[model samples]
Target chain A: MTEQLVLNYSIAGDDFTKAGEAAADFKTVLKKTGVPPDIIRRAAICMYEGEINMVIHADGGDAEIIIGADKIEIILADRGPGIPDIELAMQEGYTTAPENIRSLGFGAGMGLPNMKRYSDGFDIKSAPGVGTTVKMTIMLPKNRE
Target chain B: MKIREISEILGAEVLCCHELLDTDVHSACGCDLMSDVLAFVKDQSVLLTGLVNLQSIRTADMMDMKCIVFVRGKKPDDAMLNLAVERGIVLLSSPLRMYIACGRLYSAGLAGMSEE
Candidate 1:
């Protein structure tokens, strides 16, 4: 594992049914590459939440995962309408997802918070009419810490 | 508790992966919101919910949950079931409502998520 592995995925807008596909694929790659189970699960959860948020809010986006021996980094870049308030969005129970999305069992205002909860490092950049990019990192366990 | 025990307690019908019923499950969480499930659940192997959608199965998969018990007689459609099958997650359908089902599982020694 001397080299960093990079994986890229494109997400389709409004495709609730296919929301988690990229994260699932990423998890598979992590599993095959022999990442620890707990680290893999954390990465998958963050990726999945971000992936779903992309589909629901940003109308799809690009996901890039960089895996190294020390940590895993996930970048979700979406060109959809950027979030209005980063502070509100980070709040646990605030969401702007429409009723239709709510009907599908998402949009409980937990996506961003959940992603942050699972990742060791979290950063977000967003503008009103531009886009949003989320960078998340989960450190690999050292001595099972 | 074993999945089989959960089935017996909830009187749920195993919809897929019957062979895995004997698998052990440490904790359970019942929520209609997949986002909440992803946020709060840690090392929980069973998801009991009434949300019937593809993401439900996807949520179970991402969390490494072993079984999903659909309460209130809510059953997933064919596509959702197919996804569960692909993920190797066992699906169970129970006529009990969410509260009753959770209560039954709890009374039978099936615990919910531990406080983090």
Candidate 2:
């Protein structure tokens, strides 16, 4: 059978108020595609976390969502100061975000962790000064890990 | 317990979704960090935090939570209230701090999701 549909988005990093716009739109797309609530939730968590990363670190980037029959894949690519230490960044409590970001309910260093936790597939590629890109996938039913 | 019961327990004033006061939330979590909320919370329970911002309501909506109780007399602004109304979530403000409010609810049998 042919794939259901594909969704693409470009996130804006200019304003913090609009950080979740793309993710929220992705969520709407998922809802319209007949994804279950729990699966939609998994997708939402991953996309929102990635969206936040794009805003907080990358100053904005692009997100492409490929919604297939078996799974949904969200590839988020950003050009920001890449992580010097992926290991430390993956740690639960580690965060380099400024104090002001913490006031906004982010910078908890849990973004990547939560993304990994909610996603069936999580992979990250980064270079210290180049940029960072994260790919997270959520599978439905038997497609899930 | 129901959201209304919890509101009464904390003497909190409902800021939005007054109609949802009867919604049942069996668990509660207290945290100022939205990251911790994402890392730990589950099952659409109540969120107790002192953080006053749009992200707080957004976090609750993302978690599929039923209600948010702002402790330490933290009052939410118009943006936050508007978001709560849009999401159909119960938003309340309590004069109690984070620890005391969570403790009171815990002692009254509102268990954490992880504890169960």
Q: lDDT: which candidate is best?
A: 1
Off by over 4 Å in 1: A142-145
The TM-scores of chain A alone, one per candidate, are: 0.95, 0.93
Q: Which 10 successive residues of model 1 chain A have the least lDDT summed? A: A136-145
Please write out the lDDT profile of model 1 over residues B42-94, one tens digit for every residue: 78999999998889998999999999999998888899888888889999999
lDDT of 1 at B69: 97
DockQ, in order, for the candidates? 0.87, 0.64
List, residue by residue over A73-139, the lDDT tens digit for candidate 1: 9999999899888998999989999988887888889899989988999999999889999999999
**Candidate 2 residue-wise lDDT, B1-116, digit = tens:** 99999998898998889999998888888888887887764684899998888778877877788899999888888887887887788999999988889988988889887755
lDDT of 2 by residue, A104-139 (tens): 889988999999999999999999778898988898
